[model samples]
Target: MNLKFTPLACLLAPLLTACGAGESDETPIAIPAYTLTVNLPQTGTLCVDSNQNDSCDAGELEVSGPAGARQLQSQAPGLLTSPLLFIPGDPAALILMHPAARQDGQHLTPSLLSSLLQSRIAEGTPPHQALSELLAALAPLQPNQELASLHRLQEFNLALGELIMAVLTQNGAVPAPPAASSQTRVWPGLFILLPELSRHFANGGDLLDLQARLEAILLQQQPRALVTASGVSTYSDGTDYLLTDEPADHPGQDASLKQQPLRYRKLDSQGQPLPDNASQWDCVEDLNTGLIWEKKLDDASSPRDLHRVFAWEFGPYRPTQDELDYACPNSEAICTTQQYRQWLNQQQLCGIGHWRLPHAQELMSLQHYGSLHQQGGQTATLDVRYFPDLGAGANGFDGYYWSQTLTPSRRLESVPLAVITPIFWGSDAGTDYPTAVQTPSDVNALQLRLVGEVTR
Candidate 1:
């Protein structure tokens, strides 16, 4: 919602922009006229959309974190140097450059934090359970007590996270704890530190040292599923499938958003009444969004081919040992991600094989929270009639599905590219809904459901 700009030399973050023209001829050296944009997870578009079209249009960058999407763009700034845009007033800006950029990894903005936090809450994920998952994501940076200074700062920042979440809760509606647990718990210093942290994050501080500290301490909250802005791209296995997250606009107040609808259809045409027999393999269509989904998952009884998964570098690089072996027999001329597109153009399943992966938001739309016991309803984890058998863990055919959408951050050769994977169930419980993760790209562990747009 706010904007600031600095030289690219300081913070080498990603760029997202739209510009009219450059400086007049009087200027000898062309300086980048920076336009910094922050995508408010408050809307889920990750700030990439210059027009707020509910989609990432050209020139808009997607950022992750509880801070929403933060983007810096220039019309003529050459590749050599780009300015770093910071919303001093937005706490999410601190993380966008901090731990993720500091560790030379990825940073989840504050908007993303709210999305993860609120999504879990809305879907009935226990607060502690959701918090634990985020903490686990941060566990990789484990230093819970190593630095007294960092410990103190993290606690202060975490309280700020709570404060921001309160403000983000749909129309600022903070839920009261159940009567049974409300009396036993206490939120210490939560009120006292809110104003201080909010001010510190907003001002972005003049003390360079303070900026560094702000970045470091936020690691304490250590959230996961931190959303990121990604551009459109399709993946090709044997076939090209467009990928995206679940895109159904939820009606209730969620932390990641104020009042944006999924902007897409919630149910497919055939979803209302599943076939009584097992023969309904026809892809179903969501009239509103034009996205068609596979009726069922790949057969669990059949052996899986993990090598089928590939990163931009190509060749299912991160598969399980079993998958690695399976990928070995006569495997040459391995199809890189680029080559996969050619495959997709040729793929035609259900009389429509040119499928693509869905974005994280687009794909997430499939979850039927009503199916979860926590949601107090029973409709099946998803539109069971449409997406029957979206399994979980190492067992069933259902599990994490692949999305072709790429992150706003660059790939670090030292480590795999971080990406969001869609999951349907957590434990063995039949009632669990779905959730997502911002983890390294891996495929041997899960399968994918194909989705695409069909025109009559």
Candidate 2:
């Protein structure tokens, strides 16, 4: 992005040289007034090859012409012109300006020109041919405004050329005259998918048009799907939960699949429901035909220190009633009940059991959309209809949930090979929100979410 210019005085020094001709009276020769037109690629570097390796191996040459104009020559190809004037066929010259090397051993090439063009098109320039016509009108010599102006124009052309080349190459639509050979090879169509070119795709032309083309290509060459499984139920337990038999035929015997009615009560310090609310707890049904969940408060002094516990007697696992309570504590003093409940369902807690803390990796897995920032914070919304029990009120909480796994700086002495834990944000959380957990110590506490897989 940096541009440097040489001063006009330095540019004029060589042109002012004393003319030496035959000692005798000989007529002075006039230089032909031929215009030099340099065609530059849209986005590549330019340089002169002192060694003639067909590569821009040498440093950029400082070029000065008629008038007090000077320019730093770039590896990128572009036209330079002398001030219009009558002169001997041969004129004295000096290196007044040169292109700065941005990196070591970097050179210019036709491909670089193509890349530059692609970038310009992505930036909203019209078709390549139209842009080329416009660029052709630029004069070789920039007025004395500054050398930077001239260099910038050159760089612009380089960028534009690169873009044109990229699009043409990607679609296999480039002209065939430029055939691949040992010294120069045509780039593969797939090169358009590179990260560098992706910027072009994201910003080039109409979004709808781009999306259609990309989707068509992707569908034609479907990528392999990646499937993953986690949770303790998937590990080798005493029994296979997936194969467990249930009472599906007999209504009365189907208690194994029936859902237990949740009990609500107002309690005092002694753990007894208030006198008026006692009936609320008494009405709770055992619902034993299906799995059973017991909601209880962990002993205040227990090191586990959780507010609520949900104990699942059967099925994969269930969030401890304590966990739910922690999420929706009865009092604001205990925790933000409203926020907690919203997070629970948003993170998919209704179907799975044993809502223990999620591991760090499990938390990160929720980010199926890949790097958040790179996508400009745009992500698809999640479907809430699947988990009707989560209820309609559980919305708008775009925060990170914690995992059962702890990300320890050092391995735990008790478990040497434990996997590191990370927090994951639900798709509903939105990419703009930060995904971090808060722990009791200097570290942060992590929230755990529950999930179960179903094959359809």
Candidate 3:
């Protein structure tokens, strides 16, 4: 969508100025004649307030960005996104500063941030990269500040510059560092920046949406696999390995589903597990989804010490009151959704480059929960026999998992406020954890977890 701005309103304030004292002439002023152009952020209806009345009057002036008249309306709303595509963050971050950053006597101002951005831009840094550095600079100072509200780039940059300057000029008022606590807060800049980051991921700009579109074109006729076929004959959960008994070509899968034993080993396409000496971390293949997952237990505590544990985190949004006390599940390790993908790529899990965080629908597809003994009630929503260790350990966040979907609160649109989390557990009536009709992301659930995948 393109918005072309034209300053053509032909009116002035009710009060006027006398042009000549003797003539007692009163001349009405006209709005300035200027031209401005802006690009629409997405495919949406455009309305311009032609009369400056702050309302979209009938046949009002153009409200879209500089693109004159071109606009894109998506029949499929899920495909909405910014700048046309989604990519993991590059070197850019958002830095917003407070309108009044300094005290009565301080000299630091929002302009410093502007200067930093200007210099970075002059040096050829992309706006995004410049933003990343600006936010990074602000992160170290008051890194543990609590997030007070949602943020935007413009104001955030102002506050970021303000915080850095204030920290640098500190007169020994910094608090004593607390005794060791994993609960220490995260960087304020990051806390504030995540929501904006999440917005960039909305409207089909993300990998999930990209894959969905691609999958439609490539596998339209094929059924989507939600329930996995273990191929382990010992456990016949009655899951149909085949939608039908007729021979089928595995268009989505390179390997056919062949029955194996419960003691199945992680394998590459050639069917081999990680070398025997270092088999602690392993993968699993979902014959149903043709996607490989990294077992939740396969991460940290590895003898090899892969840096699997990340800081507890949230994407771009503030939490509600009921969500405030919730911490990342003890069952989970603090890892971001992005790292989950990077690891898959690094390990070349199942030898596939496209291993990614699952979409909400894709993640929920795994939840075919029933009260069968093997399922172990609401506590273990997945097949515990095959994935027996999932909810067992001291820190397992058994019935919850992350999805690569960003959603807005039910009431607001401009605020792309929440990441979708899927509940793998059962009713609260039967369990300790509160049950909800909808599963929203737990802001503190950054380490929520990664399910296992194969060698691809």
Each model's TM-score, in the order given? 0.33, 0.19, 0.33
Candidate 2's C-alpha runs over 4 A off are 1-355, 370-397, 410-448, 452-456
Give per-residue CA lDDT, model 2, range 1-456, as digits (tens).
222324663354245322232123333454433222222222223333233233333353322233322234433432221111111112121011122222312222223323323223222233333235223323332212322233344443344334434433556553443211210211222223323333443344322234344434333221211122111111112343342344334223212434232222333322233454342221111111111112222345421222332211111223344443444444332232223334443443323222233223333433323222211243322111111111111222323343333222233444322223332233453232222222122122232233222211
TM-score, candidate number 2: 0.19
Candidate 1 residue-wise lDDT, 96-192, digit = tens: 1111111122233332233333233322333345445544443433424221222234444454444433432325454442121121111212222
Worst 10 residues of 2 by lDDT: 383-392
**What global local distance difference test value does model 3 have?**
0.36
Please, what are the lDDT tens digits per residue for candidate 3 over residues 1-456?
222222331222124433222233456665443222223323322333223222335753333333223433333322121111101122121221211111122222223234343333322233445456555545533222211111223344444333433332335454332211100111322333434433433332332323233323323211333434422222221454434332343333212345221223444443345543343434554456544555554445541122232322223323443332343234343234454456556665445555555655555544433324334444544444434434322224444555544432231333333345566553421122211212344323423344433332
List CA RMSD, all candidates.
Answer: 24.2, 27.2, 20.1
lDDT of each: 0.37, 0.28, 0.36
**Which 10 consecutive residues of model 1 have the lowest summed lDDT?**
179-188
TM-score of 1: 0.33
